[model samples]
Target: MTEQLPDTISRLYADPGEYVDSDHPAVEAFARAAVPSDASARDKARRLYTAVRDGIRYNPYVSMRSPESYRASSVLAAGNGYCVGKAALYAAACRVHGIPARVGFADVRNHLTTEKLRQSMGSDLFTWHGFTEVFVDGAWRKATPTFNDTLCAKLGVKPLDFDGHADALLHPFDGEGRAYMQYVNDHGSYHDVPAKFLMREMAREYANMQGEDLAGRDMEREATEQ
Candidate 1:
């Protein structure tokens, strides 16, 4: 899409749907708690990125059971989510604070995924991996709030960072110098998460990991065992 006017972009970023619900009380409260009134948009975006990155525990064993699980407020209230849920929360929180934000997806290979998960998913390629693109300083910057600090440490991979300027993409190597991740395909950005598209992709790509849904699957245990 072409560059949108600031007001138009802001409107596009705000949503009241199953995913990226900025109007929800929990998401509003979270945005309020993560950033102060005096903070600049860049500062607020950084704080929100950090808050979502670390605050929400990442788990993939659970199912996407219903539309509610995709809501930013719902994910915030639950205190844990996978990459999609975490990114949704970050985008929602940004919109709640009047920061233009959108969700972007990519097919990633060899992320800090565990052997069990890799086998369960039948491949190392994870489709629809989510991230936030915050509009700030006259340009949109990408940030991946997945893989919290502890998880990064456990996986021996450097934690990703975003300064509200450069893109905080996945690292190309682990701590031991092994190739860590690569973005196989970019699905572009969207004001709202394409939930049906994501679900269908998950169903096709993660059939072995599915269990009625894909929300709370325990990934920490697998990570720890590695």
Candidate 2:
């Protein structure tokens, strides 16, 4: 049985934020279409998780300076985004179904990144790696819909899955048994995208990202080359 949410955490189901615009028409429609109206909370969460995970492609080559880059609706319309945008979209979709959800951030060392991406970021340590946290079955469960199936196939990594009951974090090793991702630091969870703080920290950490035009670059192509 699903447990009741406390007063403090109930606000997570309140109106959407600037980034996680769950009230947007597209997000609402997408969420509704992903699951049946009679579906239970866990079923809805599982369906929405997979819909966002595979429906939208994961593309790391995007301009971080643009606000639209982080907006959930924009990410859905564009059909691609990095971890942050994808997480925002997943949270937004969950909210549309009256599910309490939030975005979580962590610093992870990606040991299996492509060379061009490694050079672009200047390090394999990715800060603000985003994931979705949904309150289901009486607990806040983490769900990472970052790496899509196609990209994971190209990179020889298994796609992350969400069971709506357990945390779906990144794997510690790839298919070849090589080290893949390691969580170094956690930034906790937020009801909305902390855009200003996130951009400020990102600017301070990644000097090359400022004014960098990452257009036309394809992460899938790079993964295939590796």
lDDT winner among the candidates? 2
Worst 10 residues of 1 by lDDT: 209-218
Report the Cα lDDT for candidate 1: 0.81
lDDT of model 2, residue 51: 97
What's the distance in Å from true for residue 216, model 1?
7.8
Q: Which stretches of candidate 2 lie over 4 Å from their true place?
A: 1-3
Alpha-carbon deviation at 147 in model 1, angstroms: 0.8
How well is each residue in 1-226 modelled by candidate 1, as lDDT tens digits? 2365567656777655558888888788889988898999899999999999889987766465455556687778888888888898999988887888888999999755888778777888878888889988777889999888888877877778888888897888998888888999999998887887777777777777665443344676678887
lDDT of 2 at 33: 95
Query: Which 10-residue span in candidate 2 carries the lowest summed lDDT?
Result: 6-15
lDDT of 2 by residue, 42-84 (tens): 9989999999999999998776766777899999999999899
TM-score of 1: 0.91
Model 1 segments beyond 4 Å from truth? Answer: 1-6, 15-17, 211-217
| Reference-based TM-score of each model | 0.91, 0.95
Residue 169 lDDT in model 1?
A: 78
RMSD of each: 2.6, 1.6
**How accurate locally, in lDDT, is each candidate?**
0.81, 0.90
